[model samples]
Target: MAFTICYAGFRSGFFTIDHIHTVKQLIEKCHEYNRPLAVTFIDYEKVFDSIEHWAVFHALYHYDLDSLVENFNDLQRTLQQLYDACMWVGLKMNMSKTKVMANIYNVTNPSATVGSEMLEIVDLKTRLYNQCVLPTMTWTLTQEAVYRMRVAQRTMERVMLGIKLIDRVTNDQIRSRTKVKDVGNRITKLNWS
Candidate 1:
């Protein structure tokens, strides 16, 4: 069974950045040691609403995973076992959304299958770029949007400082008094990080 970290609602202290860093370190270590590493990402369709809690607990209690999976066959077997368990629990795995990533030094292609479908293999770099960078690249702020945001910020600042446009206050003076970061600069910093 796959365990996912949920960051919604009141959950605290578990961040996605920690997972990304851990994965990066694992990949680096595997590359440095010239070890073959294959990672499978599984996605379940409608897990929360479809699956029953009692069935989930029963599946977890019955499932036995003892040894480390060393190769593709073992991985495939493990996946099949997981698929069976999930099927028993009324949870459906989305085959199209599942993907496997392996190290570049691996000579043989890692073929992992669930039921009759073969999972797609993706390059780590491509996957990372697509997930992390592509969205940032595609997020464009229009001039009108930026102007509106700035105006809103100024209005908020004026309300906080109890000042109006007739007060003849400069934006720099208001910004210095308010000590708040500019929206544009904040966005730039967020994108950089």
Candidate 2:
């Protein structure tokens, strides 16, 4: 089933190691199709350190683009309003390093960034990828696409562990209960229930 989490708290924020699973699934699919896949890593370090007031306010109020455009003033006014809001809240956006691009976007799959400039833009699927990569660093918010492949890998590991445990337990139970005259009969009775 598809999962949708509308709202959540800070401590239990939805970020998890789901990307690791998706990467595995993608690799498997590539092998099946005999296709090549390219992967790249990008970094945004200490972004919050340089946030100017305007950027924070812009992000806060201008969440949805189509809706925000209705109230769109010139960039100067919009940035000013954002700055005002930041002053009120003591927050800022690092203008110099705040990277915005047509194709490059923060997604849930933080590790695997997908951007095909030549390809027509498909529907964007975004998930939050927040993390405190270092103990001293602050938590950062990011969004990315869900990686199906990582999920497949995790699912496989769980299934394999379960099978192994069942086998070991079943063997032990059979050996321990060998004295029972009707072992198969007892097992059949348990199965039906």
Candidate 3:
């Protein structure tokens, strides 16, 4: 293999750690340049299982690239090889749910992003105010995504109460009836217990 994935510090076995690290590094690098970074979170179907094992790695390690065509030839060839190897072992990649999102962050102009096929560029600054910038209390917010979540919670609550949403049942009324603790309260109770 011409390219080898650095497995030196991957003992933690957590891909999210890489995600977080990537995001942090992106933030730092973009902050320096005052440029926005877009991150596409791909939904690979069982890639880790196929690539992480010693048997598959050995297969890919020996697979040589004799013929090449266009861009990303190595990636294309390697993927085909991996697919063949996995099929031989009775495993397959779900190419349908495999979303190839290029990036999510919008810096200056969302339109300025690269390789944009069908990515919807949402304003992270506005939506992430609750989780990224403000306190968790503030995350129970009346903002765009937050409002939708609260509305969903209320709708579910109303459904449980057998009440029509058009009947003008307030969220407070549903809360009073259900007496269900919110997630934060539940967490606090668990900690205390």
Candidate 4:
């Protein structure tokens, strides 16, 4: 069974899976090492309980991991080992949906596999961020959530304009383009006099 960290139903405390939490962890570890640490965040789909316990334990014991940090070579090797472990345990990885995000000086694309398909870290993040993270963060419709959604929409609009997805952009254009409600941006009827 997955713990609170893996499943919403079991959530007990503040989630450490968020980017802010991950960034804090990275900074803390980097300070401990006394050098800037290049870090990557990997996410898997349906990761709740699909993995076999024995396989997980075996992989953990087999690998000499001092905090799951990986260099390029290590990441490749670990990817191979992960595939092998999944094969032995009858577990399948969702590579297309899996994501890897990194904050580093420079990064070459890293790769992972799912059922003979190879997926790149950067592209995986682009797809999954739009599909998963953005929606989950925006769905609550609270003041903060609504504000974030608008900010994201604006950023996306800039990207769209940069890529020539739109001829030009205006506030009206942005408002018409997205269904996201700009909840806190408007004055209420009581305040309008």
Give the top-scoring candidate (TM-score).
1
lDDT of 3: 0.46
lDDT (Cα atoms) of all candidates against the true structure: 0.69, 0.33, 0.46, 0.50
Clashes of 1: 0
Model 2 C-alpha lDDT per residue in residues 88-186, reported as the tens digit of each score? 455544443332221122231222111211212121111111111112122222212113322332333334223344455453343222221222333
lDDT of 3 by residue, 1-193 (tens): 3335433234345455665786678667865664534443334367566555554445545564322222233434444665566555545556544322122222223332112233344334334433443344333333455555555556655654557978998878777655444534433444522
Better of 1 and 3 by lDDT: 1
User: Which ten-residue region of model 2 has the weakest summed lDDT?
Assistant: 123-132
State residue 97's C-alpha deviation in candidate 1, in Å: 0.2
RMSD of each: 17.4, 21.9, 14.3, 11.4
- Tens digit of lDDT per residue, candidate 4, span 21-50? 766877677555644234444444455667
Residue-level error in angstroms, candidate 2, position 106: 24
lDDT of 4: 0.50
TM-score of each: 0.53, 0.23, 0.32, 0.40
For candidate 1, the per-residue lDDT at 118 reads 92
Error at 29, model 2, angstroms: 1.5
Best of the two (1, 2) by lDDT:
1
